[model samples]
Target: MIPSGHPDAPKLSPLKQLHWSKVPAANTRKTVWDVSEESIKLDFNKQILDRLFCSKTNMSRTGTHSTLRNQDKITIVDMRRSNNIGVLLSKYKLTGPWVVDIINSMSDEHLNKELVTALIKCAPTSDEEQLLQSYTGSKNILSPVDQFLVEMLKVPKIRERLNCIQYKQSFDSLFEEIINGSRLVERCCQWLLKAANLKQLLHLILNIGNYMNSGTARGNATGYRLNCLLTLSNTKSLDQSITLLNYVAKIVSDRYPHLLITSDPLLEAASRIHWKELSNHLVSLQQGMMTVQKEVERQQSTVGMDTFTTKMNQFIKSRLDHLRDAANIIRGVEQLYDTVMKYYVEDYSSPEEFFSLLHNFMTMFKQAHLDNLRDMENDKAIRPKIVHKAERIMCQRSLSTTSLPRVSLNLAPQQEENQDTVRSSAAAAAAAVGSNSGSSIQTKSKGLIKNFKNIFLRKR
Candidate 1:
């Protein structure tokens, strides 16, 4: 695959090289005319000049405005043709830079696509068969515009200008990000190695982890992988009510609160660093550097220590040397991190991996610490209310226990009176019924008494 922003020139697509051939019309009437090359060139130049300066008034005076406006209008076509645009270029003395300037002056909206299309007519081929048929029919192609573009590409300066127009903005932004991000990464890595508080915090984490894993076979492992830090919040007690990270946060708060913010810079660096974008940026910078080097080499050969190219060469060399130094620093930072991780009984293979682990742990640690402080504040606010509710419950239980016996004693007489009343009602019902229906009346009275007892029990 071609590297992005490379110095090597791009190959022209197949459409640009299409071979257009003449197709004869059967109904055309033969006519004799004397058309000289000079007249033809003059006519072509006049068309260009007229188009550049033409306005509505001129078109109206020439009686061609209606032909231009109407879709169905048929007018006489220009019959003059050429195999190349060399004659026009020679007449105008238009060099590669001049062509580039014209192209650049056009709006970018049309420059990317429309300009190329306007210069030539693409051959119509829907499939391989059609393409093969086109190839068989035409070997001498009419591609004057394509030939012009090809000639311009032969000039290094023109080619560079074209490449810049296409890719300059994106490459510059990417390279800027790479340079800034390398500095941040290197700084973070250095801080990680030298910061005393960070080392102490890691020690605390290691001790707590070992204690938690005391009974397991892996408890005494000499080292850990950086990724294991992400599971700090997931490690739970037997009851699964809280996490290891929460406990760790509490310990840090009670003992060493300063370490809580130690990972902030590291976390920020990790978040801002984009591994894939950085890698791609570096590759592109290398390619762009190669392009500049090639251009400088060309200038050195042609002009020999000219002011413009000499300054450009110096700038490129200095920046390239700085970039190379950054690459070396990055390598050293990775090595230093691996060493530190190994010392702390951990292993990490990449800066991205190491920084990601630290970032996740730092995030979880901050959240857990904040949650712990909030919980403490809530407890302080509601402690009195909880105590008051407990006291009220105890007082009600004591009152119920002390008055329950007196309450029972007072209800004993009432229970006797209710039994007497029930007996009198039963006698009345029995007297109202006949001796043969006495059994049914007795059963009815018993049900009524049971319902009354249930009601009294419920009320009590």
Candidate 2:
């Protein structure tokens, strides 16, 4: 449920506030938002970092790419003018305590002044930071920088960062909070699966799916998205994955309709989309669409230039306008489905083993939980009625059954009348409909087909 404004909501921390505050800027005449977009985009670089840090042969502390003494510290910053992330190291590494060590002695105002002055001199939001970045400077300036630096700012990533900053209030330990929240939420979801009534669990899943598709949820929704996929990934091993995927897919396909992307950031990334895998979703509908077009073609007999695009569109949807709409949905959802299948789907030879793994996974989830949702099953009983509706929809998909065009034919009685009369009558009708004069009939048919431009053109 969407929450009403909470009057006594706790204040956000500085870092959290900075990352997520949506401050409205007044416009001279036009309404303009004075929000700044600052973010860090991670791509294939993380894989490299993971290689360097997490490698078995690595000498770094834990799985970090950079090795520093325990006394050393690193800072994560955003100094790239193009809205990319930046990293700076202090030989050791920077922790909360280290950051405090650097500026704790200074007054809050003084610290603010130094940070602001450093930000101003380093780079504009649209410009590069030359201070910590230059190779041959005076060793360093008197300010801090991130431990890692990356360049590249996707417009969507920037928008996401801005939205996160605006919506998420700072907590004491954001990382811990995220970790704790994620584990507890995922675990509670599992308990609800077995303990609660089927309808209740479905509602929770639907609600989470909705949160994913909503704009406000884009910030923290990734955690849950990952959680859900990871939970479902073992389906092949546990038989739970396929069943749950079927259940979840049915629910989303039937009810939510927007669960594949929106709030799921990883799904929004470009390279993650798999066009071939998603092709299965269109097969059933395309059959219907084909039937529709065949009838239309038989009746009108026309064709057009966008024939390929039209046929492909009809492969997923029937009506031209609905085809356009469905295309948009497919394009938007494709990336997400690709990511899920790529990361999660596993192969299994038997269903028993798969379900065994699922039970083990649920056990692990229960142990990892940080927060306890009381009477999860009981709470689920209070779930909105929509869950039941969604479940029913799962069994009887509206798309599965479609109305086909009715073909009507007139039948004159084959009475025991004179056989010659029947033959003559049939012969006359055939002649009128082009039984003889084959070449002339062909010419007339050509003329008729020529007149039927759309049918010939739009090969539906």
Candidate 3:
């Protein structure tokens, strides 16, 4: 048999190993396992020596390089353990070519808002920066993600660029909120000033209230407070079946059916805004601009900070103009709000309060209108029943009072024939009485129905 160490030796199977002891002693040779084990030990020793030599070379090149700081070591360890850099690269689909383009340009315009925000969260620390700056190892030894970060750190003032991007994003969001809120406030004010149907409805309410309070000290009042609208549901008829608001709704439906004064979506959106909240946002925006200005001034002398400062200067100039315009809009909104409040004789502390009160009043009015319609429907359905009952009662009474002609069967045939004629005449008279009673009952029922409706509308 060929020696186990021969170049052409077949690999030993389990069966071959089991039968090895049965082979002749003269042909015996070392098995492949012993040679393979010795080769593995030699390879391991060589790898250790190579690593030591590389370490010595790295130290000699750096000339007594300082040991990795504790923080730096921890950062590196965490990077290795979590692979967060890899995650970020994968999440943003940042290929090597795209990353190189970004690093070379040093421009964040290609990055979306979300990606920029994420990068801010994962910004490299100073410890990581030192480590990356001193790193002299081959790029192949580092991960693709780490290599990307190393290249990115080569750009000067990258952190400043990111901060500028963040500031712009924040300014945009805050400005948009302020602008939209101002527009909504403006719309609400315009609606209040120009809504003819709303004015007419208020006038009608005032007239009705004055009429109801005719004999009291409240009589002949020129106007009522807007909040007084809330009390309409509390004022009820003697039987408590209908409220003053219900009566008002009925009047409106009859006299001005087209008036729907409370259905403005702009008013609803305005009611949700708090003036104080908007004012705070405005202040924050101004403060943020001041901070940006300070940053730009501080960085004016920085060698590589020119791009950031220049861009910030332009931003400040343009946005300052916009900020001034926004401030004017806020002031205009406040002025309009105050004007509307004074016009209505309202004493609200804020626009939100004023609009919320109006919103509540509208809700109550809509409910009352629906209730009035339902009550009217019920009244209509019951009216015919009342008239029919009245006619039936009248017919019964007339039949009971009328007498039938007496029939004399024991008398002669001529007498019987006369009785028949009498019967026919009595029947005709009764039919006439019934018809006349029905007509009179119909007239009475109509009067009763009118009185019933009046009762619901009558003041206590």
Candidate 4:
């Protein structure tokens, strides 16, 4: 039976080792350990020696990240002093490629993952200019694994794929596949979303259309970009929104599909962009559209109103039916003169000639609709005058004279003649006036009293 530490680790003894691939993928990793479940442990003490060149990758800025922390049994890292690590790396003679074989061939999930992580921590954070110069102690050339990891950081394709990936996967077998598989992706979805700008992604799409239709190179643009733009036009998500417009220059070429590009630039802006600014920009664009619509409507209304007025004016000028009654009288006399002069005033042998001309004129005028024309003219001419006259009559008022004289001279003279009669005359006059005044007051007061008395008496 093949032992666990046997040289032939690729194929294990079925009865003792449980050939991993034979088991379901879910339970494949459960190994028969020589010790208890807690016996498997991590040795961070050897970390300074390992400098795991295999696992280091570019720290991604596009994705969310936490500082690599020391967890419990899963993975353990103590906050070690950099001086300690530096002193450790100094003594080591790392004779061969540190990460080459582990990354290229290793299948041990735990050791591989931990070693890569340790390598990432070893990467120069503060003085990267000096660290990259060292080249990880490789005099001839860096190993494929180390060089690939370093280069993958800058690749737009890799960075974007990494960003799209799940944040926490306990094992990283798929991580390498994800990185390598990015190059195999057919559609430029990752590029479209990952591009720095719409125009850049658009250019890539245009090239794709030009070169990569159904994996066959047909040299022309596609409906996909146009459709993409239309789709993007409605999206608020920046990554989704700009997929169309990125290559407009190429899509349209010399001949523009639409003379008006109705896209809102704010929609195609970066995802991390401020939403408030985007909202403001969109509002301003909407206001612009509203202003344009209003101007168009106003102009149309003005033109329609003008055209209606012109038509009415033309209709009015084509007829002579609106002469007033007073004006018609003068016009009729002039007509009579013209009719009479047409025959009699010239060389009429009898009055019959004059009648003939008058008859003909009347017949012609009737055929020309002069009767209806006259009534219309008369109504038009008289309407304002009638209204004016009615208004004047309504505004006028007539007041009746009071029976009492405005001046009391006549009353005073009558009183003075009786003045010699003195106090008795004055007293008698005053008594008569007082009696009349008192009677009027008594009548008013009695009437008011009667109304009140009647109301209360009825209620009671």
Q: By TM-score, how accurate is candidate 2? A: 0.15
Q: For residues 130-207, write the lDDT of model 4, one tens digit per residue.
A: 344444443224332233334433322222112111112221332233222222221222332333444443455466
Per-model C-alpha lDDT, please? Answer: 0.55, 0.35, 0.69, 0.35
Q: After superposition, how far is residue 36 of candidate 3 from its true place, in Å?
A: 44
How close to the true structure is residue 60 of candidate 4, measured as C-alpha lDDT?
A: 52
TM-score of candidate 1 relative to the true fold: 0.50
Clashes of 2: 46
TM-score of 4: 0.13
Which clashing pairs does model 3 show?
none
Q: Which stretches of candidate 4 lie over 4 Å from their true place?
A: 1-84, 87-96, 125-131, 134-460
Candidate 2 per-residue lDDT over residues 1-460, each given as its tens digit: 3232232332111111123645445542343443334313322443344334431332456633343222222233442532221221333343333334333232233334334233223222432233325434222221234322212121112222222221111211332333333333233323323443323433555565566467764433422322344364344425432344444544543565443222112112222323333333344344545554554344233333232224333433424444444445555443433343343343432222333343444343333221122334555776756676764553233123233233222223543233334334333333433443556654543443333333323332
RMSD to native, candidate 2: 38.1
TM-score of each: 0.50, 0.15, 0.60, 0.13
Clash count per candidate: 2, 46, 0, 11
TM-score head-to-head 1 vs 4, winner: 1
Per-residue lDDT of model 1, residues 1-460, tens digit only: 6642233423211122233664455433352234556557763343343344433222466545332221121111112323234455555555545555554453354444433332222111124223323343222232443334443443334434344333333445665677677667767766766778766777788787787689998686555665677788887878986788888889999988887853576556665676556766677777877887787677678756644355555567667775686567556655665676765555554566667777777787889999899989999989999987875564334323322221232346546556545444434434433332446644654454455445456444
